[model samples]
Target: MSTTSDPAALSQETEQRPGAKTRVGGLNQHQMQEEDDIETVDYKMVTFSLAGKDYGIDILKIKEIAKFSSFTYVPNAPPFVSGVYNLRGDIISIIDLRVMFNLPAERKPEGSAEDGLILRLDELMIGVVVDSIDKVVGIVSSRIQPPHPIFGDVNIQYISGVVEKDGRLYIILDVDRIFAKGKSTTEEAESLSAVVAPETSAASDNIDELKQQTIPGLDGQSSGKNEEELDLEFIREGLGTFRGFYPDGIADSWLHRRYSEWRAERKKQGLDVQLTGEDDADNFMRTFFSPYSNRFLGEDYVEAVKAVLPEEVSKNISVWNPGCGKGYETYSLATVLRMRYPGHILKIWAGDNDLLSISTAPNLVFGADAVPTLYEPYLVEAKNGYSFSSEIKDAILFEYHDVTHTSTVPDIDIIVARDLMSFLHPKQQASVFNEFSQKTSTGALLIVGQNEHVPESQDWQHVGTSVVNAYRRL
Candidate 1:
């Protein structure tokens, strides 16, 4: 690279023959040595102290750090249930940090668990009481090595990896593993009606009391079950019917209503715990979705959905509905489009991966009252503000296509995926989105969930709130 002719320079050049290793070696040996010594990703093990003792939890696991608030202590609950607090809007549980660390108990006069740091974890929240949380230091993640298997023998089941930093050690907590272990066990839960459900209000108060009086390493719980005590029989029974449809999967409303009523009757007679047959799975699915289906996404959501469309694209549009679960939106969109277009033809190619829906198709008609917000046609009729236009049915068509097999996909002017990606993992979602981008014409619109995204998805323009992201394919 140089036009130098000096002998010393030529010698230097020969010694530093340009390859990755040569260039690396050509650096000031001292600087290169420093570079080698410094680890970026696994820089330094993060070290902090809790309750005057060394404590370390992976930085990634910590969703947030917040000052504790008054919680509703669950009465007669398992020992580990610290309490419940309002987190944003979701009712999140808080775990006592002191109980977790095997440290000296959290001391307070009477009701003191209510005041501490809130440590949020993956699926659950723990309210660990610490004398204080020190600064979060960068510890080399690479340096974190699994401890000898012996660590498990000492209630260290939650310790995932241990990292050494600055001649100090940090303990990494596996919140997921801990949560899985914390669930209630079976036999005691089978007798749960006798053990009694803990009052949510009391759960809060006791958390404060426990915070004041808990012993360090209170591993031996005073309770009916550890988290494993879930009524597996009930769970197994509850999940059975989802494996099959009720009344031959006819998609009959009478069958749907009867299915729920019969299940309720069985549950009242304690027959709910009986797994019976695959027919029960239908009951579970209906029950689970009954609350969420037909729900309104709100005006803001509608705006977000609209924003995903091109501003200049003509009003009457063609939409491809992938995984058009029960055609709620397929029909809803059909309604609005028919209303908006008057005479312009609006074609919707609605498909779902589930063959059962296609086999037992309604072709028209949506169950009203459930998710009453999303299916506005029902709401309009109920409110006496509008009447159904028989022409709306002509705008929609439902079909079946497995997204895993992308060849069935058709070219469309727009794609409305709703909450479709939520069920798929990030990688799967990304793959599907990639497939979507390819099939879509440039400037084609794509609609996705508020909580989901198309990763490495910059090809689409960010034109709306993420709750319902709308994109224009580049």
Candidate 2:
């Protein structure tokens, strides 16, 4: 992409003869307009309890209040994963809070609908199996305080504080900590630590083994929960179910069309098929993605970087760009290295697996709006396909990649993928995270968009939120 226009060139283009009138009219157009004065509104959260104790979580954190039900076990997952049972094709995990909270083993329910409650965080769907669920109550910041040391029954560090409403006290949970306890987190972390450095399950003994139970007939009995007690029929969690809430069909219609189009575009792109999202995601990437590609790495730096990068990067440090579209990110990254390392050597690979984007990249030209406001300062010389001298730049190459296609990544220096997580389908977000983990070697940096997250379970230490973020690979 052309990406950026030289500022000096722009100034030269607009220059006027000798002494031209610098002012247009009496007042500066920019100064005359006042800044937009829009107020930011904060929403209040409601508090509630699970079991007998009072607990408060963001009311928004909840999608719906579902009761408990039997969950099908996901093979080789951690004990915490519980298992993947179908909530109408939405694979939900039954987080055995009984084990988490130090409670006794939980009795499984025999049914399709829930007996306890279902809580979701993005694409990760997990059914929190609780003794019982209380009603929803509202709370504000002023009505909350730090948890009293006395209520130390549930030993969790992520707790934010306590809340009050009408003589009621609630212990708000730190979901960041609670969900961080998942198997995916620790395993991914360990694997990344190994991959970034050098190192990298279907779990058995699901609830059936964890609880030591046998499959009983429909007319089975448990200590407290009951099978065949509730209806086995289910609430179908179809793809567009989330669009149901928007009235007049405006939001739903837009969402439906977007997702449908994306679904179709995915087939056309022929990108690594394993990395899936809403059908619309592929469409979004195919179109909007290429535009952003320039900003990701840009044409100037990509070719220059690769030319000068050090040998360490090429031989060992692989470069990863998560949202690489049209190879602008790839080319710009390579350019940065070449400009720095004229003679040094390293192993670096720039990757993105969008075939159309990749195939179309080298030929595309960028325009001004596709550019970044600033440029990376550290760069020097470049000559051919890629010749570099900077100990920093000699270490990079390019590859076409799709994170969801692999569980492990090659050894690398930095992984840059920006603004992608927010648009990932809510259903595929978490597992797709594994692909990110699989690609790095220890001490490598994993860059992400501002709003994205590494599972609390993964050991992705926060880096920064500049144009994007950088996480220590381990």
Q: Which candidate's TM-score is highest?
A: 1
lDDT tens per residue, model 1, 409-449: 44566787765654453235445665776566556777764
Give model 1 RMSD, 1 decimal: 25.7
Tell me the spans in candidate 1 whose CA falls farther than 4 Å from its real position.
Answer: 1-300, 314-316, 340-343, 364-390, 425-428
lDDT of model 2, residue 355: 78
lDDT per model, in order? 0.53, 0.49
Which residue segments of model 2 deviate by more than 4 Å? 1-315, 337-347, 362-401, 407-409, 422-428
TM-score of each: 0.35, 0.32
Task: Specify the poorest-scoring 10-residue window by lDDT in model 1.
Answer: 244-253
Candidate 2 per-residue lDDT, tens place, 11-101, comes to 5644742223345533433333522232121223434444457676665566555654566677887665666666767877777664455
